[model samples]
Target: MPAPPPHSPTSEEDIRWMRRALHLAEQGQGAVEPNPMVGCVIVRDGQPIAEGFHQRFGGPHAERDAVANVPAGVSLAGTTWYVTLEPCCHTGKTPPCTEAVLAARPARVVVAMRDPFPKVDGGGLQQIRAAGIDVQVGVCQEQAEDLNAPYLKRVRSGRPWVIAKWAMTLDGRIATATGNSQWISGEASRAEVHRLRGRCDAVIVGGGTAEADNPTLNARPPGPRTPTRIVVSASGRLAVDSNLVQTIDQGPVQLFASADAAGLQPLVDAGVEVIQFDSDSPSDRLAMVLDHCGAANMTNVLVEGGGDLLGGLFDLDAIDEYHVFIAPRIVGGAAAVSPLGGQGRNKISDSPVFATPQVSRCGDDVYVTARRVSESPPKSVSFNP
Candidate 1:
């Protein structure tokens, strides 16, 4: 390793610097759907120096790109690189960022977590050491990995990813006996849901759902900035002439299924882009959808549908966050709108299961937006969507 630069450490300033740099990571907040925020801190000869934070998708990874902004002649031969996670070494939607760090020739490397991922999994540290640089591991490892869960999940499982939306009644019901779901939630809450949809890259619904409800599927009151509409149909037929197809700015619809191309021309010609991927693997299915949208300048997707899709995703251990709307009423018939799944049992492991909903009331309806929890397992329950 090269000789260390002559300088003094600023423990107080460096810690504060790390915190401020981490905030720059949100640039990828809405854009980097499955990627979490990662920050980078660079120091030389004990003196805190250049810093970088990954802000969004297609944006620079914190360590590599940040090093670029540092004074060019300042030799990294003595600088120390600090990253929230293992630096990426695989060619992904972006380049293998490990090369970027290598190019800097930093004298030492300090990573917060072990890259359990196969592609880079320790490859970064190995590469750094190969070049005769010092490598340090496990600096705040747990917290850093927790911060970048989405990205880590994507790295481990190829999928577009999912976050569930829920709505219900005070007693945990979604609607009345006759399926009359009106005024259950108030104007303000519904309006917020619409806005959330607008920001999403697409809104996914199930096939049986489209035919049964004939739902417009468009983000209501927020339709102008309509999200790309997606329908999951195993049978391939979802009423081509519905209001949703005609009204949605981005579609007739993108269909995901094993359906024959011959039967889907009408939808295609009408303007929807149908992606025919026939697979039963939930992980594969999600990955294809996410790649399609993520590559097409769309990443964030909102799944707003009847309980079937919601429950299925939850059952698959796919939901990340939730929004549940509760109305003030009860029902008495078998016709009452229950959650996504019918009576059934699926066991869950003893994981960190908890819900924290920020309540907001509208008319007789109430809504709870809960933060994502860790270690969720499969179970039977009703979550109104």
Candidate 2:
């Protein structure tokens, strides 16, 4: 509506800028859970004049923030806007981003991927195109989708993306024969785990893990969001003095226990919401936990379950991603605990397969990341560009 800038119209340049937008989106990692992390970069004359990202939930969208970054007197009429996600056409917490873009009157818009949120699934692009503004999509689409995998999964499937994390020794032992386990991975890997918790809606674990580790599960240095701490137990046995229960005021704690389990008065009085499930089987209980998480609108779930609980989730094929941190040390003993426990797959073929793992180094630890091969979002909107 005001003044304008210019830029090269090459697809290669578009991709480079889109990647920049994607990088900006990462800034919203811990703050935007239910909402996808989106970033926008406005370029004029081959240079980025303004950029912004979805900073937090229920706040200004990336498009609005980016447009606001433009100097007060500058016009956006002829600029090319590169966004990691398609803007919205309908207003909810804030006005539709399409309204802002249309008012700014950008000459062309480049979107990395079409938004999958049903309310605006491709509608924003249609609205922009209808206004005679040129629109190009699918520029870094795979990257964009990867960045918002949890959000897309939740919106499309009504279930949170489940990520399982564990630390093990080279001997594949999670704990010593005595069940004493601590500091398996180096400091960096542990810190990364905290960062992972900050980005998720909840962190789930078996009751055994809750008692064994007595973990606080809060993000160190404090992230923008506090994830809910969940414990699943058939007997409803959580120590009232455990770190999770003692730190109730810092964050929310939830326990999924069997309907008949007892002696939870102290925990409930300490502000823990107890949800009862009818079944004692891990797979059945896991299903109920996920159902409750879905109903609560959770998008990403970080699982810190102990061996038996992890095994149950595996049996149910519930884990969507895996983060394994392998320490160089070897805690050798047949009696030592391994990463996965419970009834494992009878045959190798029945075991869940994952995409090729991504490996990285964290301090003295080797970190690996992989996702289930069977889990994928439904076909996305097709785009020619």
lDDT of 1 by residue, 115-187 (tens): 6667778887777666676666555544455455555655655544455665666666665665656555667
Which structure among the candidates has the greatest lDDT? 2
- Candidate 1 — which residues are off by over 4 angstroms? 1-22, 33-37, 44-48, 71-77, 90-96, 99-107, 115-118, 186-188, 191-202, 208-228, 234-237, 247-252, 257-264, 274-301, 327-334, 346-385
lDDT of 2 by residue, 271-300 (tens): 999998977666777888988898798988
- TM-scores of the candidates in the order shown: 0.69, 0.92
lDDT of 1 at 321: 60
For each candidate, what is the lDDT? Answer: 0.63, 0.87
Off by over 4 Å in 2: 1-10, 347-350, 374-385
Candidate 1, residue 329: lDDT: 60
